[model samples]
Structure formats: C-alpha cells, structure tokens
Target: MKPRALMFTLFGEYIQHYGNEVWIGSLIQMMSHFGISESSIRGAALRMVQQEFFEVRKIGNNSYYSLTPKGKRTMTDGFIRVYSLKNYKWDGYWRILTYSVPEEKRELRNQIRKELSLMGFGLISHGTWASPNPVEQQVMELIRDYHLDPYVILFTSSSIVSHSHEQLIKRGWDFAQIAKEYDRFIDTYQRIYEEFQRRAWNNELSDRECFIERTKLVHEYRSFFFMDPSFPHDLLPDNWSGTKARELFFNVHQLLAVPAIRYFETLFESAPDRELQLNREKAINPFIGMI
Candidate 1:
C-alpha cells in the first residue's frame, strides 16, 4: 500500500476509536516496520494534515494529531462498511442518477462519472448511473460541490420490472473479472494466514514479523475497497470466492494481533511517549466485533 492508504488503514482500523489521536513520531515508528521510511511517513502525515484529515496541535515539545470532523466521518463510514458483517440492506430499491452537460462542461461530467464509479455506482446506460447503495446525501453534496445541479437528475425506484436484477448486474458490472481479482487476493494472502496460524500455535512469530504481517494484512485487504462495492448478499454470484477471501482476512488479522502489539510496544520502549502507544495498543482491537 502507498503511505496515504496505509495511513488510512492505520487510522481507521487501529487509531480512530481507541484514542483518536497519535503522535507523528509514534506513527513513523509503527509504519517503519512495514518498510516505510521516516521521511515517507512524516511526509504522508503532513499531507494528511494539509488535506484536513487531521487536526494538528503542539504540546510543549510534542506534536499530536486528531481527526477533523471530516476525517471522523470518513473513518466512521469505512468502519461501518469495511469490517461490518452485514452489507447495507438494499430494500430492492435503486438509486438512479443522470446528467446532461454542455460540451464546455464535459470534463466536469467526466470527473463526476469517475468519482461515482469509485463510489461503487455502475453505469446502467448512456449518461446514467445506478447503485443499490444509499447515496442521496452524497449525490447532493457532489452536485453542490461542482455546481452541477442544473445539469443533473436523480431518482429512486423499487419495482424494477423491466429486467431482472441479474441482467442489470451483468450489464453494469464485470463481476466475473472482479471474482478473478478476489481469487488473486486470496492466493496472495492465504500463505500468510497459514503461516501465522502454524507459528502462532508454536508461539514462534516475533513481534517484528507480526507487525509487518499485520500491517500488510490490512493493507492488502484494503485494496478491495477501491474495486469491490461490497454488493449486498442478494447480488453476489453463487459460491463467490470473495466470501472466503473476506473470511480469511478477519481470521489472519485477529490471529496476528498479540504479536503485532508486542512489536508495536517496542517502538516506544523507553520514550516518554510509550504510554501513548501502549494505551492505543491495549485498547480492544476496533475490528473485534465488526466481523
């Protein structure tokens, strides 16, 4: 994962609820185990602050970071979706959005389309997008942000009787290819699960190794956020491999926790900031009940 994304996983998965604040020095220490350099972690931290992700403060000789309201909302959304067992219930309703922009505003329209795709909306037809996910507030925000309200229209419908949901999905998304990507993710990470389990039983995985493995665990799992829409259970194909892959992610992540904490503790073994890392480390894993 890139530093920005790794930092997001760190904040959302580890730092958000427990303390909701962290020192830059501690972040650099923790991230370095994942082969990130001091400069890179610090630079990412600065960028996050610049982007309003973190509210920054100085206390004497120390710098501390806390989530801005925007960051909190983003992290909360991530938590509720990424680690939750239940996908948002679809209620058999569809959110449909369409827009018509002048040629002079084609670039703005394209930008909206790109971002909407990333948000898991699928193109249902020319100049139209559809998603089962609730996005009314988000769409309104997007319209306001880009001054596109005059050019856009949106609606919701439950009795989509023109075609079966299956046909719409087939036309709107490449779930088959997405399935292949899920399998690749599983293939890449399954060995870590097996290895960690074997060594965990033997009490052999060192803190440093566990730290690297744990960060990579989330980093790799997070790759799906950009690609998979967490489509509701009703929409998934039969015996989807992604299901097993998601299960494996939680299993390995929990299995590695103790050792990862031990390694994280070492980051501030003698620093005055040891208590800061220790408190967050000792807090219950944010993902505990999420599965």
Candidate 2:
C-alpha cells in the first residue's frame, strides 16, 4: 500500500482512539511493521499536513501529529459507512445531479466528480450523475462547500423515459467486475480467517501478529468503499459475493480485536505524551460487538 493511504488507515483504525495524536517516533515505530521507511513516513506526514489532514507540532527534538478537525470529520464519516450494517432501502426515487462548472474551473469540476463518485453517485451521462440512495442533502452540502450552487442542479425522479432501472444501473456501473473483485476478496480472506482461527485456538498467535493482521484486514477491506457503491440488497445481482465477503471480514476482525488492542496499547503507553493520551476518553471501535 502507498504510505500516504496507509497513514489514513492507521489514523482511522488505531491512533484516533488514543487522543487522535501520536509522536513521530511512535508513528515510525508502528509503520516499521509494514516496512515503511522513516523518511517515507515523515514525508507522508508532511504531505498530509499540507493537505490540511494533519497538524504537526514540535516538542524539543521531536514532532507530534494530530488529525485536523476536517480530518476527524472525514474519518468519522468514512467509519460510519465502513461499519454500517443498515441495509439501505431504496425509495424508488433516483437522485440526479447535473453540473456545468465553468471551463476556467476545470479542477473544481474534477473534484466535484470525485466527490460524487465517492458518495455513491454514478455518472449516467455527460455532466449527469444518479444514485438510488437518498443523498440530496449530501449533494446540497457539496454544492455549498464548493460554491457551485449556480452550476449544479439536483432532482428526484421516479421515472426515466429511455431506460429501466436495471438498464440504468448497467450503464452506470460495472457490476460484473465488482462481483469478480468481491469473489477474490472472499476467497483470499476465507483462507486467512481459517488459518488465524487455527492459530488462535492453538495459542500460537502473538499480540503483535494479531495487531498486524487486524490492521491489514481493515486496510484491505476498506478499499471496497471506493469500489462498491453498496446498493440496496434488492438491487444487487443474484448471489452477490459482497455479502459473504463482509461476513468474513467482520468475523476475522472480531477474532483479532482483543490481542490487537493489547499490542496497540503497549506502544501507545510508551509515547512521550502518554499521560495526555491516557487522560483523554477512548473512542470505541465502530466494528466492536457489531458482528
């Protein structure tokens, strides 16, 4: 994985629980397990700071980093979606978003498209996107955030003249490819889960091993957020593999949780600002007890 992406995974899954801050040395030590060089970690940290995802402070010879408010909000929103078990019920109305950003602001248009895709909207045609999920409020927020209110229009419609719902879905997304990816995820993790279960039963797994495995598990599974729009069950293809993949992910995650937390706390307690971290209320893992 790219060091930058891994940093987000680390902060979201681990560091946020311990005051949402970490000494640079502590971060380097943790990232070492993934074979990331100290220089690379520092470089990634600096880039994140530039992107407003992190705030850094110097203390004597060392530096500490913490998530900015924007970063925290982003991580919180992501985690909510990642761990959500709510089966979205389609209301039979499609939310359509069409934008006509000026050519002078091409970058802004690209950003709007990226945000729409991340929010599960799929492009149905040039400058037009749609989602069966109710996300009008989110689209409005995006519009206001980008000051694109004049360039964008949103609509809710229950009818399409040219295509049926299934046809629209096919035009907007490659479900066949998505299904193949889900199959791969299920196949890979099912074997890992079986092996981990055996090791756990045999008392052969180390706390550090559990931590590594759990982090890797979450990191790998988290990619589905970008790949899967998480359509309602009724809309998914028959015998979709994503359902089985999710179950496997949660099962393995729960199996690794206790030892993973133990290992993380061991590192966290040794940080230079341990007292401050200890005094802060711990945030619960969203996946805990949700399986």
Question: Top model by TM-score, which number?
Answer: 2
| Cα lDDT for residue 238, candidate 1 | 88
Each model's lDDT comes to 0.74, 0.80
Q: Which consecutive 10 residues in model 1 have the weakest lDDT in total? A: 268-277
**Per-residue lDDT of model 1, residues 1-291, tens digit only:** 588777777777666544667777887877776789988887888888877777777776777777886566555555556577765456788888988888998787787886576567888889888888877877776676567878999899886788888888877788888889889878877886787789888988888887788777777776666567678777788898878987888788778787676666555322244354335543335555664
Model 2, residue 171: what's the lDDT?
A: 82
Deviation (Å) of 84 in candidate 1: 1.0
Which residue pairs in candidate 2 collide? Answer: none
Off by over 4 Å in 1: 87-89, 99-118, 135-154, 161-163, 265-291
Local accuracy of candidate 2 as per-residue lDDT tens digits, 101-130:
889999989978877876778898999999
